[model samples]
Target: MLRRITLISASIALGCLATIGPVLTSLYFANRDVENRDRADIQEFADKAMLRAELVTYQAFAALSDLEQQPGAACSPANLEQAARVIYNYRYVQDAGAYAEGKYLCSPLLGDVHDKDLTLPPPDYRTNDGFLIWFRQKSPLSDVRKDLQIGRNGHYVSMDPEAYVDLIDPARRPIAAIQTTTGTVFAVSAGADPNEMFNAWKHAGDVKSDEWNYAVARSSTRHIAVVVKSPRSSVVGDRPKLLAAWLSVGVIAGALLGWLAYRRVTRQLSFASTLEWAISRRKLDVVFQPIVRLADNECAGVEALVRWTLHEQAISPEVFVRVAEESHLIQPLTDLVLDKTIAQLGRLLAANPAFYVSINVSSEDLRTFRFLNLLTKSLQGTGIAPRQMRIEATERSFMNADATRGVIAAFRAAGHPIYIDDFGTGYSSLSYLQTFEIDVLKIDKSFVDTIAQDTASSVVAPHIIGMAHELGLEIVAEGVESEFQAQWLRTKGVQYAQGWYYAKAMSAGDLARWLGKNRAARTPDSIGGGIATGSIET
Candidate 1:
């Protein structure tokens, strides 16, 4: 009898363990699926919010563009008032003002412009693009409390907070903000006061406090974020009590699964942190993509593209660059790229005196003092002179207007050529050329590809080339992937070209060999000595 009882007890114990194993596994996977779905939902919300914000910004810019298009109206008081009136009649703007040279020139409310420095928050309150937006501010032009204040360069625009209020859905009750690299530009709340929530998020340090925080969604561009006050429980669906019972029955297995999940999350978060370490370890590498001159089919110069590999996996520029910029790792990473590229190309540059190299830089890098210092210091002992390196900035670089112009002036003062990379893509590309001291405008690839397509599509490239030439800025057509496209760009008066049509990116050694092979086919000897490098300013 005793042996039979012990056998039954052993069987029961084994049966229970068998039941727990599958139950725990199911619960773990179900929980993971729920978490992923929650994350996806939040991301979708962020995407929509960002799209809305962009649309609003674009609308506001359109009003300014229309005003700017009227000749001599940008600074004219009546014209400025007309511009402001146009904006004010719309639902978004409360008022508008003309800004130039870091001062307010005119406003609809205050006609006859005086050089009043805008009443602005400090630099910390502004975006990396130099846009300072606020929910409310004392207007230098008027005494009324304005709902939204946006100031960049000498320009300022005031909008009713109600403009942002209508953007979000009624169900989400989200607090949204327009942000840039430096900080938040404009923030608004639909239900609760956004300032309170923003402060809480900024000051909260503990997980307990964070638990009470809103579900946050961010834009891909990292320029906007919408914070929902809804509880996490809404998105993270509540599991039935049976899930807990099953998990409790196999606590040890559940704990092990949780540990695995934790490890996965921590590993993912380490990617951004590891960049600094990677740079210090010399893990970053550089490749040179030759920019050929369409005029002679000779390689004009090369654009340095940064490449990185980690843990035996190749990382694309798109992946790591956004991460670096978001984490404030851009400065260090940029420095690394510049250092490595210059180091690799120093001998080659020394060998070909006329060859110049263009390096891409972020607006943040251009704005920072460290960027200038780094360039000046890095080239001190190198064979390459400042003239041999051109600073390439995107259309976004000019959004800051005065600051960007000042920075470009500084680069020019240091004897470096400044080129606007990916021209014609920006909403204000032409405006930037007219307003800033631009040395070169690289026609965006999209436009170049269309240049030789059909009559309708082909007109854009030629038109841009003509406009750029008219502005006295040299043109470099990008993405000339075919001979037809190249020939058309040349006919349209494009000075330089870059794309696979000439040569894909290559190693420094490979570039040297190509340079030697094609030296005879470059531009006229006068244009950077037929090397298609940088244009020597007269």
Candidate 2:
């Protein structure tokens, strides 16, 4: 009766967990989609603003061309003033002026003006096709024109600040301000100082504030970029609210289901208790999956994989290992696996002392010095050199960089080579290679699987290999289950490989026997096809 109740309760709990996983996964992807859409919206706004700025700049240039076409217009103050008046009338023009040889020759505001002290700095950009220069500074005519000071010469428009502000009319409120590449700030709206938003984008290209997402884009034609931003709340909109609703519903349903399961529970059967029981009973064991050197088909080393069998059912490492981590039983579990692995491979290490064995380490294992001390003592007793034991870590182990770096440094100081497991399947940045002392990177099987398909989409695997090579790190390709994948990686200069194409996890006795038989050069297909199932347990 108790067994029947336990089974029924476990089934109901598993069903609740299954529902929760999909709900959470859906929420995650929905949030990602929202972010991608927001990026597109911001990019489009920047492009449109760029086009508007470019149009205004070109219009000024066209006016300059008209003045230059007029015979002696630049030399004659009357003609120049007349021309300036015509251009100023275009729009947003407060004053117009013509200057040459560092002195104003003409202006509609000041007729026949010549101020020897008047100075205009150089342009940020130049054009040889015409006498044109672009620059920005405080208005020399601030006394006369309260709002006009910034000018663009050669059809120079004496524009008020409103001139720049007006270009962004019917704007997507994302336009916080407009500024010349030459450093003149023009506010587009009256709210929070747009200069602050503009400066953020100018410095970083993209930035986010509590209320807004700021971005900067330069016109292909003009020297300045439009400072575009969107309300942070608008970008996320109601998606987060919807996600919250779904999550709330899921939590309520889970609670109800859990309650029902608990009422039916005959005896408490936690995974933590089961694992501890199994550990004490010595039901856990280690299996070795050979890491073959692709160049010579020689077994250079073996990765130690932990296996657990409880209640006549073989539990997957993914399941039990995660349970161990959550229960804080990982350190003891890791010690057990390592202790057993060394005992089993003691003969192989004695015969070929150079052979290395790789074992996986978690972030929790690295946060403390206990594992480090355990490793040192274990190897010291077994007569295994530090170089003969490779430490493997999934990229998630480095999420807290400061803590991870100390762990990595400790391993390096002890002389154990480090390998990054499942490289392309994590949040690992290219920065990790530079920041951490990594020796080998294992390309995930997902990338290797792509190469077997006859499609252009598979170029990523080769690129990953190329990137790893450029960083001066050795490469290991996982899941080379086909001759095609194997040959491709080999040609791409991948030094090592691990997959069923070489061998599955086996007992020490079975591996020693299989190694004796498979020393010759063998194609991936031949090796994959002729695997002796009776010799090695999957």
Candidate 3:
């Protein structure tokens, strides 16, 4: 029942990870796209600001053209005032003035024309390409520039940094630099990664300012690019609501799926687990499968194989052992099998000292250090020499070389021999054979069962045998079922063979009787009713 719950929990956990994986992956990519868009949006906004600056720069040109168009139009103060008012009335024109070499004769749109410091020569300014640069930056936002100061208007104005802005109409952020055809200069907002943007903009930079992204380009002034940057925090500010809604839906769906999976699987686990215990308590019985030396047809040992005593209810070691391993019951069951086999071995000890007994201990049982001590203690004083005991450890046990060597050393010192079971199926087995000191290498059943038919197995067998011989190791080829395969193994100088070809695993009494036959069955195919009638009763 508990095993059922554990399996259900595992399935549910896997389902949750599967469902959440994609959602988190999508969220990561979505945020990256939003950041790219934010950069584009800023650049677009800057482009528009550059456009506004162009209008200011070109107005000066128009003023010069107009003066030439209307001869002596600036002769009278009143007329000049009227012209200044007309020219400066254009939208986005903050204040306009005309200064000519140390005199501001008149100003339009301002009540006071003769203002302070008009006598100062052009306020220490310069003109380049028919445009003027100011000694100091002029800022409309400051109160000092509230009343216009008169000057000669020697083609000089305040630095453009104060006036630079990429507006959503009226609002502005100061920028790095903007240059005019008439050589007027305006400061540009230093948006993030501005150097990259400026290169793209000045060389016909593109505008990508969406509401979520910002990129502004100005083709008019040789492509001065402006990017209004929204910090990542703000750019992704609105995403939380959308992501939250999606996340909620995903989590709810995942939970529902998990619940269903857990419920259905847990119920199945309960059923399977119940069956297991039921079989374990009343049905589990040991059957002896004789491990034989094919060369002389002599019994070397008998491996204790398990069976469900309930006939017509075939249970698979494939499924049974798997669940045992997963649920951590393999260790307990291994102990049970080992102890029972040893007790059975004790009964046969007097009959034959040469006959060894082998039991399969799971990989997990070996890792549990306590298992070793417990096993050793149980076998103590049984008059069972460690040499008389042989343990078949599956490949998984040897996967951890350090641990396997440590345990094997302990077992060997205690007079027990350890064989790596299910060889050829795991990684680095040949390498391990070279590195670790082991007594036996049991070939995997897959290769053992197909020795004659599989070319790979046929070729690999010789190489394996040679390697084992080089290592002074004994080789046990399991799952042999045919006379031809057995004879082939004998010819290959295989030391041991175990499979249905000799005898199916049978109960202790049956095994005792069978061994009492005292005669070797040479041909497996000749056995009557697919069974061996030969029985040895000692």
TM-scores vs. true structure, each candidate = 0.51, 0.49, 0.47
Best by lDDT: 2
> Model 2: per-residue lDDT, tens digit, 1-538?
9999999999999998899988888777877677667667666556555544544554454445445444555547655655664465344445556676555565665556564456556544454554444333445656543343333343354444444434333434545434454465554544436568667656754554556666676654455566766665342478676566567878778777887887555122346556755664457988888887788676778899999987889989898898888866676688788888778876566456657889998877766444666687677766678888888999888878886788788998998899999987888688877889889999998889899577674876888889988999898888889888788888889999989998899888778777767753565654543323232222
Cα lDDT for residue 108, model 1?
Answer: 74
Lowest summed lDDT window (length 10), candidate 1: 529-538
- CA shift of 202, model 2, Å: 79
Off-target runs (Cα >4 Å) in candidate 2 are 1-269, 452-457, 520-538
Q: lDDT per residue, candidate 3, 1-538, as tens digits?
A: 8999999999899899889988888777777776666556455445445544544444444344333333343435654554454354333344444555554534444323455434434433334444444434333345564221212223222223334453443234334443323222234444434454454434443434343233444444342333343434342577686467567878778777988997898666654454445433434556678888776676777787765533477777676677767754565466567666766656564345566778787775565344556567676777656676787887767777775677777777777788888787777467667766679988777776667664666666677777888888999988888898888888887899988888888766777766656234545543222222232222
Decreasing TM-score order of the candidates: 1, 2, 3
Count of steric clashes across candidates, in order:
3, 2, 39
Candidate 1 stretches with Cα past 4 Å from truth are 1-268, 455-457, 520-538
Q: Which ten residues in a row have the lowest lDDT in candidate 3?
A: 147-156
